[model samples]
Target: MQESDGPAPTSFPRPPNLLDGSRTSLRQILWALVFALTLPAVLIATAGFRSGYRAERETSDRRLQETARALSLSLDREIEKNEMVLRVLALSPAIAQGDFAAFHRQAREVGLASQSRIALIDMDGRVLLNTRTTYGAPLPDNWRESVLRKMQETHKAQLSDLHADPITGQALITIDLPVVIDAKVAYILSAAIGPEIFQRIIADQRVDRDWNAAVLDRSGRIVARSRSPAEFIGQLANPNIRDASAMSPEGNVQSVTLDGISVRAYFSKSPAYGWTFVVSVPVTELAASFQRSLFWLFILVGCILLGVLLAAILSRLIAKPVDRLVAAAQALGTGREVTGTTTRVLEFDTIQKALADAASDIRAQERHREEALARIAESEARLRLALHACHLGSWEYTPSTGAFEASSQCRAHFGQGPDGPFCYDDLIAGIHPEDRARQAEAVAQALDIRSGLEVEFRVVQPDHGERWIRISGRVRSGTDGDLSLVGVSQDITEQRLADERQGLLLHELNHRVKNTLATVQSVATMTRRAAEQGDEGAWDAFMGRVQGLAKTHDLLTATQWQGASLEDVLRSELDPYQDAMRQRIRLRGPRVNLQPGAVLALGLAIHELATNATKYGSLTLPEGRVSVMWAVALSLSPPVLIVEWVESGGPPVTPPRRQGFGTRLIQRGLAQQLGGEIKLDFQPEGIRCVITFPVKAVLAEPAPAEDSAERYAS
Candidate 1:
């Protein structure tokens, strides 16, 4: 056998056509019409049932809410009326004058008329008198200490939590009022009423027979119930009712009763006493109305079924001719010969001839489709090559399947093998650990908002180290109507690094120029002062100060102006003096670092001190000596820098007649510029100078800028 020049031809099973081997008889089409009509009938029935149920539920809920609100108002009015009775009794002169017998008789008369028990208690919570019993008959133990405390604290009348009377064991709620005598709580007058009073108020609201009404205290205890006041009073209310009551001052909830029957409950909370009034109606009542609507729907559907049966008989005659034409079309689609088949209907005959002509046209189009597919494949190859050359990668994500498809270049950029399957998790795994969360969050937010995604993150490639990559994409709909994320990722590592470097250089340059200008300004001012004094050597001294500044600048530049070593700064200024004096000069102490600003100030100060020692103080004689020492005071908060300059073994020192340019520079200019203190003492033996300033200002470094890449790029 000869070897093939191209890959061997492969055969694929043909996909099933939707219309192949499928036929719909005339009878089926007629039945389909009948069923289509039946669909609306069923929908109408469902809509009617839903409409009726919703209306009934809404009406019931509205009525229940109204009833609850009405009952609350009635209860508040009754309580207010009783409070008025207590208020009137409190103002009686007998109560304020401490005439217990007279106040008791007056309170007893008012309590009997209102059908409530009244009592007087002192501020210490001791019962002073009870209308039900004799005056001070071995007063009962204080049962409502919390209520009494509230009355005294608020200095107003308030309702108490539901409690049972100790003597009669009947459920009762109290209204406690603080009796104020000259701004002091002299006594508390309490009015205790039974739960029956609230039950009567609820009953008088004219609630419907199907509805049940209840009143609950702030503690969620059933103070009274219209249906069974004697049984449910003083008991904790239903949990669902308590929760619904707590959620809103007025609202409705669907809950099941204690008997397990579903009901709609509406509630309103009283603002005055913190009580909740509830009204419940059974769901079965609403369902009863819906059943009537459903019955009519069934009757209408039965009539439609009878009409469909008559149409089914007529469909057989029409189905034979169309069925023959359908078979011919199916056969023609499959490339089978449809030799002598015929239909009696004119429409069917016309369709058969048109399908035959279409079959011929389809054969010609198939050839063009194959050629287009070849061009598409070639274009994809060119795109891959272009992407690789530009250090760019292409990727697509299918949300429906959570599958990720990436080009070979994309896989390579992320340090994954080209043949390995790529997924969302795999892509995230290649991101730098510090940037992974931020990158993931950006993608998640884009997906949530259904918008375009643009993010930059670092990827740590196994072979190439870390690289910055920028990705940009947008959400689009595919041919099959599924959402897809398509985007390009470009390597930006080189650009980012270049920008960072440029920013660092710019910042250093700016800092150095500004500092140098400030130093020159100070030098010019001091030079002018010396010249004004008519010093013969002022020109030479000014030149020396400028030269000292230049030496310190060179040292700072070596470290990019981060800082200079204290030893380096001192040696730069003192090196010449030490060379001439040799063993007579001494330098000592721990090493330290000085910032750029401090270096300039200290350098000039050291030069001036060294010049003075050489001219008059220590270095004038062969036996004269100068010692320079510096140390960091680490014990202080933020630390401190201390330097001492001492000179000895020369002629006795005397104070200057008046301040010169050098003395003023050392005392004011150096101290102000360095944010430090300097002391110069003309001791008889020599000159001693001490300088101290915070180390943080001298040694502190500037923080690196965020987004330094942009600065460098600019």
Candidate 2:
């Protein structure tokens, strides 16, 4: 221990006297610190209370405003959706052709889907057709007359105020769009929207239960209410909201609701119409929140007062014992044997006793440290046992002594006996000449950098012949300043063989990935070519082909990409139709295993055939039927497989003027992709397709395949 320039403590006092300097100093510091910390805390609490109350007010105002705006947006979107539908209906050819019957049917479908009623009116405000009734139905008098007058004045689109239907007394609103031809108003399209749609929107919003929300039309009538909707709907909104809406499009005001509840209400009026949506929260709730903030502040102030009282009482109790414990501790640090003394405190008295015997105990621990360390030698024996069990080896090399030591297992790795004199030279001799120099370089570099060594090399073992060996080791310094390398070694012959096979598999995988990407790119190009011709079904057709490819890939994956049977491929494309038609669609084929390439080509062909049948072939008629048949011609040398697709009982079939993408894929792409021939015939009765490919192209286990077949056959 080094001596300090400061004064040293002689001994621990029995107990610090009340008049002792340390006890007095500690007591004074505790009192001063308590007041110093408590004063600022009290000030901060007071400031925080004021700020928190203001924050709560602002947050409440923001929530009310945001909720009002959000509710208005929801109402606007519902109206906008129907308005868009109206615009689309205006473009209906039947409306331009003065075909009210056809337009009414189309409008009825739109109204059912859009949750509204469609009404068509002429320039004279006379009803033509209303989907709520039917084509040429009797019209009620003065139906939306004022609304139609306003819609004509604007000559654009209009949203009507909330009103009760005269016939049903249900609250309704209307989205009116004028159909203009040559800058002339030919007719007005009105979509009568019920209040239930708005009610659903308000119900779906995630608002607090304490908040009340309502949607109001231009007339200040309630179209939908978040609470008590059935009872309050179709009634006039609160007077405060109406007054505020008149003053400005949006604002906040304190008012009592229709139910006589005092609330802070925020209203937002729709920009398109004068309709307004209001969100309100009870004023009493704000008062309750303010009380909660005050309640917590009072609890914090009480805790501060209690802390001051505890400090005054505890300071005197612990100060003297703490002083004595510190003195005893300083004596132990000075390397002096302390004498036990009482402090009248349990922890302090125990500490004093422990300090008194600390010097003697330290000497005893130093003496036993070596004895504890000697037990580590047993670990080496255990490690040797472990290495033998794991078929691994351990070795140590000391360059200074030119000595090499290894476990019995390590000797066996190099084909040496356990008791054999296998020294440094013999170990070097066992390494294959080709890898010896590389392993030596690794060892040299590790030693120069003082880092770990990891080297793998081929070992020429006497018993096992050639074996791959991987050794991992690190440089270690001995207690006597000598250096040695200690590490473990294992045979990796099987791993080396597996790596070779994996390299070949990876090469093949890369080739397949490129081919698959090319196929996708080709499909996209063909689809774009079809789209350039204004084919509306281009996207659907493209997605269907891609999905067919994916499903075919799934089938290949199920069999580990070896092959899928011809029947399985056919069923994949036809099962959906077969499930619905017990006998109309039939399949007859042998278990001809088709490789991945064949499956892909055949899957696209079948999908195109099925799509055509559904659109124009036999499948379009209730009485029509389809037949798929295939057979393997084993009689032919290097045999071939043929598949036929026949359909009958459909409308008279005729050939198209020019081939489309689907037809081209069937006739040209299929033949090229499958290395085969295909034929398509459009007969008077139905369509017929014949597909033929070499049997080897579809063989599950072909005799060492040709260069092309091996690509997709895996």
Candidate 3:
């Protein structure tokens, strides 16, 4: 047994060729091939699954964010609407007058309309009126002291945190506003709405069956929940939700629910009320499809293992044909025509033919794509031309990149070069200095609300000229997931100028109407005084004077109130007398234009003189005659107008012992209105009168065509 320590007999192992012939070696080689293919296939499948899951998760998150944002916006609108109602009620005169009964009635009406409870409280939190109760009914001892205090301090509308209402014992929030009177806060107005309203909002915005939505107050208390509102109302939200809500005003988060369900959640805070809205979908639902994919992955792995065994068996027979087919497919993929490769295997030959057919189809598709691009370009060109013709310019601003794109007309409006890039700052710079801050604020508000922008502002050009522009736009998200504003701008300078002119014309018209009313009143009073003094003919004389004034107004109106010619005024007043006694009257004037005021005064004076001539001075007798004439004295520094009225060929003329209303009107009213002097001479032949006034107040050029047409018609 101590045998030879030197060496033991050694047996030689089989050579490589001998081992290759054995079943064990063949089995080992098959196993190695299966593992080599299976490992990479599994790795690729796993990577694909992971990537797909990540994409799905991100999509879900974005959808949840949108839903949350929508819900929050809806809540904010409701709250703002309620606040507006309170503000309107606060502005009521009854509220200012402390007419509690009347204010209560109105508040109750508004409450019924809005489906909410309205309450009026004093600074000390004492309820003065409550719509929830009968008129003059006693209110509960407890009031929303905190809300009242906040509204009083802020002097603006304030929304309260969630609390149990004293009347209904339901979770409610109050929107409070100060009732201001005499520039001081007199009382507080509150609109209390239950959480059930927000619950309805959540119901409307719910995404799907598996999704949950909840609205939370500033203190993290659940005010409303899409599911189990009765149970969750007034309760603190889950810790994770509270933390996430505290972190940001809007975002996505992954967390577990109180019931231990994983979820992807999104939340947004209301800008008006500081309430948070949450939308969540169960993570398990998202994972269900992923689980099914994993199941298929395992089955695929088994099939791959079986295919490895068959592949090893068929490897030698089809190797050359498959290699040629692969080479041909590679060439086709590289955009080269497959011409030379040939394969004897039926499957390989069929694959080669299919590859060649696919290449042809691809070339045809390429041609179609090029044609589509050309059409798109043509359409864009046409759109640009249309915008330019309309004097409208389109623009886009990407906030993330601070990039701005503008049409040619838009650049021109901003006084920018056509070739250069312009940004938000450039747009602001182009705005007039007076309007720059206001426009910036408008844009900021639009962006914050994600709403349309409509503003009219002035833009200063390089030459310092101002042009009014109206910019109207809407907020949208771009393809790259960035916020963008797209809008159109239009030149409105002509429109603004037209508006100003219209305003001036209205003002002038108002002034003229007031002056005419005063003159008519004075005439009526004077005539009434004369009639009271037993002059029965004064009424008829007054009517004739008013008619004279009306005739003068007609002349002025025809000329657009610019002025009236002295000749026209005289002719209009004396036309009736001239018709009655054609050869008895003579009128002469050198186109002397009279201001509207002067026209009224001088027309009345001529009417009085003609009346005297018809009644006694000259026209009483058929042979009697009268002459009226006017002339301008250019020798004076500002020039002067002189009008003479002479009557002749009548019975003996005598000065009246007592001045009548007509004589006084002719002397005093005419003098005061024309800012000049008047003389009345009673000569034996007839009555003679003279008027002298500065021509500058009653001088104008020839009327325009339109005015002349109106004058001829008058």
Question: Evaluated with lDDT, which candidate comes out highest?
Answer: 2
What lDDT does model 3 reach?
0.76
Residue 631 shift from truth in candidate 3, angstroms? 1.5
Give the Cα lDDT of each candidate. Answer: 0.75, 0.78, 0.76
lDDT of 2 by residue, 572-609 (tens): 88777763536778765445677787787788889999
Per candidate, the number of residue pairs that clash is 2, 0, 0
RMSD of each: 31.8, 19.9, 33.8
Give the TM-score of each candidate.
0.35, 0.48, 0.39
Q: Tell me the deviation in Å of residue 609 in model 3.
A: 2.5
Tell me the deviation in Å of residue 65 in model 1. Answer: 1.6
* TM-score of candidate 1 on Cα atoms, chains taken together: 0.35
The candidates, ranked best first by lDDT, are 2, 3, 1
- The stretch of ten residues in a row with the least summed lDDT in candidate 2 is 705-714
